[model samples]
Structures are given as structure tokens and as C-alpha cells.
Target: MKLYGIKNCDTVRKAKKWLEANNIEHTFVDFRVDGLTQADIEAWLEHTSWETLFNKRSTSFRGLTDEQKADIDQAKAIALMLEHPTLIKRPVLAMADGVMVGFKEADYQGALL
Candidate 1:
């Protein structure tokens, strides 16, 4: 399994702790350091909608100009996410089964456990 997120993100930390406590082995890929590719984002999009993967509440998203946020299609969203990986949300878990965006203990329990 692989977990992708910014190293400093609180949600990512929580997810990591949960995984460790549950004895789920996972490799963590810090977006800030390891970087993300277009293909990576595309693969994630296959599992979840762009809206689900996109972190509109993030500072990076909020910092965008109104023009940049207007009528965002999939391509536009992917472009923005590629430019600002933090905009892709936290603790995106990817495994052979599928990709999951964000961290919810209950959801993880169902999907992972």
C-alpha cells in the first residue's frame, strides 16, 4: 500500500498513526518532496471524482484567483493539482484494490480492514 500527502499535513499524520496502530504496512510518499506526475493524478481520478480528490478548502486552492477557479473541468482541475499537489487533498491511499482520497477512520476500516 502507498499513502500520498504532504508530510506536514495533520490529516496525513493521523492516517499514518491509524495505519501503524492497525498494523497496516504502507509506504508514504510526501508530495512536497517526492513530487507527483500527471499520470499519477490521472490514475487517482479513475478511482474518485475530481471533486472528491480536489481539496477546495486548502489554502492553495483558496489562494487561486477567481478566474482560475471558474468553471473548472477535469483537465483544469488536473492542471491545477499538478501545479499544486496540496490541492489534491490528504492521505490519498492507493493499493491494488483501488485509490482512496482523504482519511476517515470508518471508511478505512471498511475498505482496508
Candidate 2:
């Protein structure tokens, strides 16, 4: 499994901790350090919707101009995420089964464990 997220993000930290506690072997790719490619984002988009991948609650999204936030289509959302990876949700887990965005203990247990 490959976990993609920013190293400093609280949610990412929590996810990593949970995985370690469960003894789940996985590779963590820090978006800030490793950087994200368009291909990576596109691959995620295939499994999840733009709405699911896009994090509207993030500071990066909130910092965007009103016009930028308005009428967000798939392309617009993808572009925003490309420019600011933090705009994507935390700890996007890519597993053999599929891609999961964000972390929920129950969901992780059900899906991963």
C-alpha cells in the first residue's frame, strides 16, 4: 500500500500512527517533499470523484479567490489541486483493492484489515 499525504498534517499523522499500531506495512509518500505529479492526481480521480478528492475545508482552498472557488468543475478542481496539493484531502491511501481518501478508523479496519 502507498499512503500519499503531507508529513506535517495532523490527519496524516493519525493515519500513519493507526497503521503502525496495526502492524500494517505501507509506504508513505510525503506530498510536500516528494511532490505530486499530474498522473498521480489523475489516477486518484479515476477511483474517486473530484468532490471526494478535493478538500474544501483546507486553508489552501479557503485562501483561493472567490472566483476560483465558484463553479468548480473537474478540470478546475484538478488544476487547483495540482497547484496546491494540500487542497487534496489527507492521507489518500492507494491499496491493491482501490484508493481511499481521508481516514476513518472503522473504514480502515473494514477495508484494510
Candidate 3:
């Protein structure tokens, strides 16, 4: 399995700890350093909608102006995510069959554990 998020993010840290504790082997892709391409974002959007992909609750989103936040659609969301990867809700888990946008403990228990 593959997980994508920044090393400094708390959610990402929690997810990594859980995986380690459970003996779940996962490859972590650090967005802050490794970076993500537009193509990668597009592929993730295929499995999950932009609404789920974008981290509207994050400080990154909070820093955007009201105008920048307005009239947001899938394409616009994708563009923003490409520019600011942190705006994309973190630790996107992916496999050959599918992908998930965020790190939820319950969800991980069901799907990963």
C-alpha cells in the first residue's frame, strides 16, 4: 500500500504510528519533499471527488482569500491542489484497485487493519 502526506502533519504521523503498531507495511510518499504531479492528482481524483480530495479545513485553505475560495469546481479544485499540495487532505491511501483521500482511524480499521 502507498500513503501520501507531509512528514510534519499530525494526521500523517498518527496514521504512520498506527500502521507501524499493526505491522502494516506501507510506503509513505512525503508530499512536502517528494512532491506530487498534476497527473498524480488527476488519478487520485478519479477514485475520490475533489470535495473529498481538498482539505478545506486546513490552515492552507484558511489562508486563501474569499474570492479564491469562491466558485470552486472540480477542475478549479484540482488546479489549487496542484499548486498547494497541503490543500489536499492528507495521507491519501492508494492501492491497485482504489484510493482514499484522508486518514480516518475507523476507516483504516475497516479497510487497512
Candidate 4:
């Protein structure tokens, strides 16, 4: 399994800790170090909708102007995510059969167990 997220993110840290405690082995790809390409983002966008992948609740989104938020369509949202990867809901886990985009202890236990 593989996990993609920034090292400094609290949610990512929690997810990593939970995985480790459970003895679930995973490769962590830090976006800050690995960096995502448009193609990679597009691939993820293929599996998950832009709305799901986009993090509207993030501070980065808050920093954007109302007009910018209003103008967010699929393409625009993709561009924004490409520019700022943090705007992508984090710790996107990719497993052999599925993907999970965030961390919740119970959900992880249910899905991973």
C-alpha cells in the first residue's frame, strides 16, 4: 500500500501513526518532496471527482478570493490543485483495490481490517 501526503500535516501524521500501530506497512510519498505532476493529479481525479479531491475547507481555499472560489470548475480546480497540492485533501491512500482520501480511525479500521 502507498500513502501520499505532506509530512507536516496533522491528519497525515495521525494516519501514519495509526497504520504503524496496526503493523500496516505502507510507503509514504511526501508531496513536498516527490511533488505531483499534472498527470498524476489527473489520474487521481479520474478515480475521484474533483469535488471530492478538492479541499474547500482548507486555509488555502480560504485564502482565495470569493471570485476564485466561485469560478472553480473541474479544470480550474485541477489547475489550483496542481499549483497548491496542499489544497488536495490529504493522506490519499492507494491500496491494491481501492483508495481512501483522509483519515478517520474507525473508518480505517473498518476498511483496512
By TM-score, who's the top model here?
1
Backbone clash count, each prediction separately: 0, 0, 0, 0
Residue 5's C-alpha lDDT in candidate 2?
A: 98
Q: Output the better candidate (3/4) by lDDT.
A: 4
Tens digits of per-residue lDDT for model 4 on 1-113? 98899999999999999999999999999988998888777777667788888999999999987887896889999889888888999989878776788899998999998
Q: Residue 87 CA error for candidate 1 (Å)?
A: 0.7
Error of 1 at 96 (Å): 0.8
Task: Look at candidate 3 and give me any clashing residue pairs.
Answer: none
Scored by CA lDDT, what does every candidate get? 0.91, 0.92, 0.87, 0.88
Where does candidate 3 have its weakest 10-residue lDDT segment?
Answer: 94-103
Against the hidden reference, what TM-scores do the models get? 0.95, 0.95, 0.91, 0.88
lDDT (10s digit) by residue, model 2, range 1-113: 99999998898999999999999999999988998988888888888999999999989988999999999999999998989899999989988768999999999999877
For candidate 4, give the lDDT: 0.88
Cα shift from native, residue 11, model 2 (Å): 0.8
Clashing pairs in 1: none
How many Å off is the CA of 87 in candidate 4? 0.4
Pairs with backbone N, CA or C atoms under 3 Å apart (clashes), candidate 2: none
- Model 3 residue runs over 4 Å out of place are none
